[model samples]
Target chain A: MSQSDYDYLCDFLKERSGLALAPDKEYLVDNRLLPVARRHGRKTVAELIQMLKGPDSGHLKVEVTEAMMNNESYFFRDRVPFDRLGDTVLPDLLRTRALRKKIRIWCAAASTGQEPYSIAMQLDQRAELGGWRVEIAATDISGDAIERAKAGLYSQFEVQRGLPIQMLMQHFEEVAGQWRIVERLRNRVDFQTINLLTDFSRLGQFDVVFLRNVLIYFDRDTKLDVLARVRESLAPDGYLLLGAAETMVGLGDLFKMVPETRALYRPNVAPKKPELALVPGGARVA
Target chain B: MKRCLIIDDSSVIRKVARRIFEGFGFTISEAADGRQALDACVTEMPEAILLDWNMPVMDGYEFLRALRAMPGGDRPKVVFCTTENDLAHIARAMHAGADEYIMKPFDKEIVEAKLQEVGLI
Candidate 1:
């Protein structure tokens, strides 16, 4: 691919999906976009780029974006995050939102649906979450990804990556070499195709937003822009989670980093003092 | 025979580590979590421990801290075998008193070599 062609493709993608493809990513673009070109019956990536620049290339852009965005995902990606979410974060959210009687969660960039499904599984395990009105909205930029997430089918290798065998047995049924996530877990999550760079007001507000592992691809400006949008969608007392390596530092003042957990961020909510009172006789209240 | 305890939440990982130790003539004990591993460390008093970083009840870092707090002659040499391969994770593990750090999907030879270096074999 020529430098100009690469630049054209990058600019197109940046405008459409907010993915700022660097110059050095030519090889990656060639490898990933070639199949997209072939799928659209184009002879070369340059031709595909030309088509993308043309007035009537809406369908082609969608295909290219979908191709670029579909990522490898399993029942659980990193076990530690899920553990922290289940043990610490979810419980805190439940307690904090007790009076509200409802909770909204959004899994941003929910590739193949594993992350939201895993959360749903964890919530189901607690039994108490069932009492609350919980809505899980999972979105990915790729329509293909959203479709796959909806299917809830996973291969053996994919299932084994992070999911424990007990969870596998409990929540999935084996069909040949693949495992299908049970209907109960599938029903809990609402999956849609949503680009983070674009306006997400349609998603409404979320008490917890998981935008993990998807920000590394963007440049600083895009990260900041996406973070702002995410901040807007987040409820006042909401939590925003990123990948282990990603952080909100220097990028935005919309979130405060939660201590100890590397990627956890909280919206600008006033720190509530612990409920404590002194007894009339000078004893402390528990 | 040298007694070694393998502390990990993953059954497959423990099974693999058990096979590796069994090949080296060490008797193996197992614990599913950090709390169980601490209890087993006192009761069984294994010579060495192959610990995983993440687990339920308690994590390896907490287990290591408790093991260090125990009276002398009971604390076992520990090697962290986990999927956390980042340099920061390695530094944290070493700082927490892990004798060696081994990443998961570990080669059997490397496991044996680390065990030999630590005088566990």
Candidate 2:
């Protein structure tokens, strides 16, 4: 592909999806878009780009953008975030949401559903959550990924990655040669196709938002924009988990890190003043 | 170094496992069947055992049971490796004290991930 075509594709993806592909990623564009080109009977990626620029090419644009999305994810990925959910987040929510008896979690960029399923299994196993209504709203930028996540089917290789045997036995049933998430567990997660660059206010407020490992791919401006939007979607006490390598430094004070945890943050709430308490001997303690 | 015993009747599987485990910095040992694996455990218990199902003389399930019955057998994390994908086989292995199981035709990534799941790596 020529420089002009590559630049056009980059601009197109950036404008639509907030995916800022670098100049060095021309080869990556060619690699990801080649299958799309072949599927549409176009000889080369350049020709596919030409068709993208033409009139009445909306579906082709969707296909091309979906193909370019990075959907790499696995069960209980990185482990620590899930551990924090069980040890810290859930317990806190159980107390804070006791009156409501309802909790909502959003896994922004939940690729192929592993993260949400992991969370569902964690919630299901907790007998304490009995009679409480829990909803995991999992969304990804790619419709193809959302469909696969909805099916809850996984290959042998996919199931093996970071999934414990006990959880596997409890939550998944062997289907033909592959494994599938049990329907009850699968039903807990509501999957949707959502682009971060678009309006997601309709997703409503979430108690815990997992936008992990997705921001590193975007440019600086897009990162700030996405974080700002995510901040709006989060509840006051809601937790936000990012990739281990991602941070909120210079992205604004929309979030503050939870001490001693990796990539775990909570919406920035001002510290409350300590109230004075009367002591037995008439001494006041603050 | 972390120790791992690779038990399989097939020399090919053993060799592949050795290369993969060695890459993960494991001191590797080999066994042909369940009986051999039990004997090796008695001699020197490894931190991890990668046992194949349907081996000659003794299968993985038998070895797991026998190993768990031994004095220091419960110390090692046992992972059953096999072509059996059915829930029955998996349930049997887990019932016999196997920490995890992986299907056949696995690669280094699968082995590494399974080992990680069992806290072996």
Quick one: best TM-score, which candidate?
A: 2
Return the TM-score for candidate 1, rounded to 2 decimals: 0.67
Estimate, for each residue in B1-121, the C-alpha lDDT of model 2 and write its tens digit. 8899999999999999999999999999999998888889989999999989998898888889899999988899988889988889999999999999988889998898898887777
Candidate 1 global Cα RMSD: 14.5
lDDT of 2 by residue, A1-286 (tens): 9999988988888777877788898778878999999999998999999999999999998999889989889999998899999998999999999999899999999989999999999898999999999999999989999999999999999998888888999999989889999999998999999888777889999999999998987776677667767877999999999987888876767688999998999987753323332222221222
Docking class of 1: incorrect
> B56-117 in candidate 1: lDDT tens per residue?
99998888888888875335778888877554676787777887766666767667656755
Task: Supply candidate 2's per-residue lDDT for B46.
Answer: 97
Scored against the true structure, residue A194 in model 2 reaches a CA lDDT of: 89
In candidate 2 chain B, what residue range of length 10 has the lowest lDDT sum?
A: B112-121
Score residue A264 of candidate 1 by CA lDDT.
Answer: 82
Candidate 1 residues lying further than 4 Å off, grouped into runs, are A269-286, B1-121
Recovered share of real interface contacts in candidate 1 = 0.00
